[model samples]
Target: MNDEIGRRLREAAEAHQPDRDRMLARVHRGMAGTAVPRRSSGIARSWPKVVLAGSAAAGILAVAGLAVAGSVQTTPAHPDSETTLTVPSPSETPATHSPGTTGGTPPPAPGHPNRTTTARPPAGTPTPAAPAGRRVSEGPLSAQGAIDPHSTVYWAQATLTLDVAEPLTAFTVEVRVTQNGGVQSTGQWQTGPAGDFTVTAQESDGAVVYRWELKPGRTVPAARHTFAVQYNHTAGARNADADGYRVQATASDGIHTVQGGFTPAG
Candidate 1:
């Protein structure tokens, strides 16, 4: 054969000999553990010492921008609980100027109250004289001052116990009272301008005579009618304000009947 196949390929290229020193001693021990080559002392490799260290960090940021524009109005470092300005003194200014301070309209404080009425007046009218002498207590029906529970304007308060004689003649007196009897108070002549007779009906027996009866087609004024039977502050006045009211009488007139009244008012 061809020289024994060229002598076994030259003994396999003389038994592979190519370790290149052992791969150059393992790349010089891996470039001898890196990091360690400073000493350029900056400027030497220079870009003008990095442009003079960036112009000294921009002149320390332009002197810290002129120390924050010279403290623009300093103030508030801490200290203020009351600079004082309270206010609230005018009512013509008189808190006594100052001393415990006070002048008026501040009284109710002793008992605590600024404005209170809640509401009242509907059920009041029945005390027929007992304050000491005006005697006239026939059977619980007495509170006769007539409107003015606090200034009821037109006025109203009627009570006639009977005893007339001081002045009674304005269409011959004719009073009435029968609302629950199902309406029956024929209107007539009483309210001012001198039309007289807002209410003056009599004759439960003593006969001051004429309680109410002017119905000749009724032109309207009243037996005592402002509104027939009116005495309503009914808590505050509304509708049927008033007319002939304030009649307190105690009868001795012409004769006989325990007498007990209160009209004009106290």
Candidate 2:
């Protein structure tokens, strides 16, 4: 009976014994697991906030850089503070015209034949109406002065026609051109024989004078004759209103004198 009681007490004490090593192992494992998650969760939450802040700063920098680049593109290379720059577009650009081409025809190209070019005169200086075939008569001489039809803007020719009803023993013809802006004589000619006349050109009293006179003992038979004078002028249609011509002759009937002024030709 003593042995049985001792064996039962031993079995009960073994069953109630505490497992200290197993409990200590479980507690250490639980603490390690909880500590790792706390550190990992803290890093995860802060990483997103840092990324978001960095993205916002990058966007602001990009916008500022674009604004600076735009400013550089619009500014002038050399700026003048007192002047304003106006850049004309292709559609609004102005056309260019040649100098000395106002109110007159442009000069012909090289090697081109001469032609009659007409245009309207400038404002405030109207072109005069041309007269008909009118003649000024003095005794037996009938004379007329006219501007040539082929006159150009830079040059002009004036013609004087004389009709003699009788034989002439002495004759003289003269043409006077006023100095209306750079007028200068170029040449003169007549329909009569060149050796039978004495021709001269001179400047006097603000005019260019061209004269043709019959040589000594030279006789002019009753006929019609034409005389012409050419000169250069300003680059525009010249006004012949101040130009004139005169003729004197000793005919069979009497000494006759005639004078006239130039009229624009058709």
Candidates in order, TM-scores: namely 0.20, 0.52
Error of 2 at 136 (Å): 1.2
Clashes of 1: 29
Cα lDDT for residue 94, model 2?
A: 63
Error of 2 at 169 (Å): 0.5
lDDT for position 7 in model 2:
50
Q: What is the lDDT of residue 108 in candidate 2?
A: 35
Q: Write the per-residue lDDT of candidate 1 for residues 60-169, one digit (tens) a residue.
A: 55554444444344444576677888776687665332222323221111111221211111244222222222343232212222222332322233333222333222
- Model 1 TM-score, all chains together: 0.20
Residue pairs whose backbone atoms clash in candidate 2: none
lDDT at residue 180 of model 2 (Cα atoms): 83
**Candidate 2 whole-model C-alpha lDDT, 0 to 1:** 0.69
* Cα lDDT, model 2, residue 65: 50
lDDT of 1: 0.31
Return the lDDT, model 1, position 248: 35
